[model samples]
Target: MKGDPSPKTETHKITGLILAGGQSRRMGQDKAGLIYRSRSLLDRATDLLRHLPVGDIVVLGREDTKYGVRDTEPHLGPARAIRNWLRRQDKPMNLLVIPVDMPELGREQLYELLAHEKGAYFHDLYLPFYVRAAKASAVHASTERMRDLISAFDLTELPVPVHWRTALMNINTPDDLRALEERQLG
Candidate 1:
């Protein structure tokens, strides 16, 4: 169920929510603030989301962006972040959720996911998902595993483009980032 893509529409009021609230245990610092190719991951993620057709965009950490929502409940992870935002919404919200550390996720890559009305998943990499507001309550009720949330909805796994495969990985450590750099260089 985690890697599955369910049926649903992709139109209207889609909020591009950059999930930048993680504790960055692997990176030894705030990965969101880390610079990748001269731009901070936070800036990079927000810029990528801006190119999408989403109605609004918000960063879950760091106020450097135009619209930033400080994590009111830190250390709790993505579910807490979603729950916190859900309480502030007037109705069910459609979210194109991305992580700050994913430097390889570009506009084109996101469009692939958006192409599916039911939403998309990365198979093994369950993040950068299309989260429907209707399933938020169910996710909260279920396991905290981010995978479980996608499982509740029918999500289709977009075939990873050969060129974008390595880059799509969530850069969790400096080594991971360096490996990406090496791949690019070599």
Candidate 2:
């Protein structure tokens, strides 16, 4: 459960992780590189992380020369991808994980997740998680689903406000992207 309503301070030293290594099977193209509001999804995700108090940010599932940490295996799904990445870490720190396809996610939403002292995610959502790296070994689930991973950690679930629901929209297909664009424009 969430211990305090206070915001996490700069001294907390959180590492931001952008999960962008999906195969984009439904989108038919790399969703990470997809353009939205004139910026790539990866860039948008990175920019959102940069605005937070995180100490460092890493982009997983990509091979960029900067900030990118390639997964040992491609298309491992979000849970396994995260697990693999966490296993390579040298020290323990809080991790803020977000997906590249969530183009509508904002810093305000992310701040809400970070407000929890322990591991937490929005109710009914798996991405945009605040996980304690020290507890990585506690996730022993054999399933690769993110929901199972979250449950294994016993992370608190913060209620998402009605207005912020759209912020959780994940653009997995071209139609989804078009719908988001229309909603944004309309």
CA-lDDT, candidates in order: 0.74, 0.83
lDDT against true structure, model 1 = 0.74
TM-score per candidate, chains pooled = 0.84, 0.91
Give the per-residue lDDT of model 1 (tens digit) for 1-186: 232223353334688889888889988999988888889888898888777777788888656567888877777788667666666666777778888889978776676676666678676777787755544455455445666667766677776768878667889899999998787789
**Poorest stretch of ten by lDDT in candidate 2:** 2-11
Residue 129 local lDDT, model 1: 77
TM-score of 1: 0.84
Clashing residue pairs, backbone N/CA/C < 3 A, model 2: none
Model 2: per-residue Cα lDDT over 1-186, one tens digit each: 343225544534788999989999999999989999999999999999888778888999888737998888789799988877776777777888999999999888887777776778998889888876545576663748888878877788998889998899899999999999999999
